[model samples]
Target: MAHAESVRVVFVDAETEEEFARTELAPGQLPDSFEYETRLDLGGESWAVVRADPPSAAQFLRSGSLVLTLRRIQTVDPQEMAYSLPTIFDPLPPTEDSTGSGEHFVIHEDDWRQAELVSRQLAGQVEAEMRAIHEVFRQSSRVVGEGASSMRVFDRIHVRRTPIDPLSTEVSLRRLSELLPVGGRPYAGVRIGDDPGRVVDSFVIAADPLVVYGQALGDRVTVLCLAPLLDAATESAAGLEQAMREFDLVLADWCSGRLLDASAVGAFLNQA
Candidate 1:
């Protein structure tokens, strides 16, 4: 087996591309594994490892060290975060068609199965959370419909609630699976509203608590909430339940027409 006397890991800001820190690991202290999005602790701060210049462990063994780029966890965007596990094969290069339009990359069956497992897990979590949220509205709301991924509730008003798994949607999954891959990390969340192109509210399970209010006119969607949901970190279902309890209150107000716009939702989240 190839081995290195020492390994030097350099950390850089993902956004600024500036080196923030570097560490040298003796052969005995070398990490068992290193991969994209792996979190490292440096100076009491969390950083996500993004890239390795030599690219592989074998290369590191031959070279003894490689450059690593990392982004501060706090500065990472939720949308850019890796939601899926890494796949075994790189996407095949696009091939030109007769008309010169390139063909889409094909996903491997194993990768598809991996992504499907993640999608199912996320769907289950969403359903479970929605059920819990539904209980809060039990007195005033009645169920109109229910499915594997969504539920419809009606009080004096109607709302469709669903778990938003961008990975499960045929369109989104096909497009994003190449980027996000399939992973155990939870990236799925819930949405409550009538349509994505209209007034809607959603919560995303991210590094931070994220609640968004959205409204759309034609093809343009406008976001209303500028505040994070409650001052609490909601990375798990338990944390989400607590946030949802608070959200139910705001949703109740929205259903009653007291809070009519995204600004109201933003105010409620900021206050809470």
Candidate 2:
């Protein structure tokens, strides 16, 4: 597989021309066309990508360096906003069993709403816990106050589904096993569901602080995880150590499924 190249998108204010927000887009995530009215969610605010400087600069957004000028907007169309945002889930290919039975795995709109609610709740809880933990760390002189800004908790989650095969299973297991041991913790692991023999795999993705896991049943796969935006460049040695300790705590809960078990969304998915 070809390596995916990411583009750094810089969002600048239209009025003051000052940079307000920035984010990195994974390869294939950027839209082919940059519409003038395309609205983006930046730090919970809706900002429209008005235009690119020189107009021709828009073409570079997909392949090379990119800059976006955004104007704050009062209201956004739901459909337009949905199109502007990065896709949360990609359609899974039809499996042999699904194709043969003519019964495809369908995700309803309500399912997405439930998932988003769960994600928001989890993010809130995480932020609160981290703040409290940071306070303790500050008092103990383990980390500085600025270290708290190194990690960002996201209010949204990303879900992806793919075909489950022996090759994919082996690859997933191997990757999980290879995760560096943190604080002498056991190697990350996967779980199996007995009801229908679904494989439940969970782990943090390399290069990001995302806690990801999913369940695969009858060839239908659904992976759901929260994306915790990290500013690695801003991390100091003390900050990095503090962040790692925080991550270790969360990863342990995530791998054991206790993290999701405490959420209503988890209950819904479990029953579904």
- Give me the displacement of residue 47 in model 1, in angstroms: 0.8
Encode model 1's per-residue lDDT on 2-57: one tens digit a residue: 67778887767889998877888775554445654477777898877787777666
- What are the runs in model 1 whose C-alpha is more than 4 Å off? 75-272
- Encode model 2's per-residue lDDT on 1-272: one tens digit a residue: 23337677777899998887777886476666674457777778887888864343345543456788988888756533321111133443222211111211223322321121123223445444434434433442222136655432222233323111212221232333234222222223232212221122323222232223333343332333332234322222232223323232222122112333222322322232
Q: Worst lDDT window (10 residues) for model 1?
A: 109-118
Q: What TM-score goes with each of the models?
A: 0.30, 0.24
lDDT of 1 at 86: 19
Global local distance difference test of model 1: 0.39
C-alpha lDDT of all candidate models, in order: 0.39, 0.37
Candidate 2 lDDT:
0.37
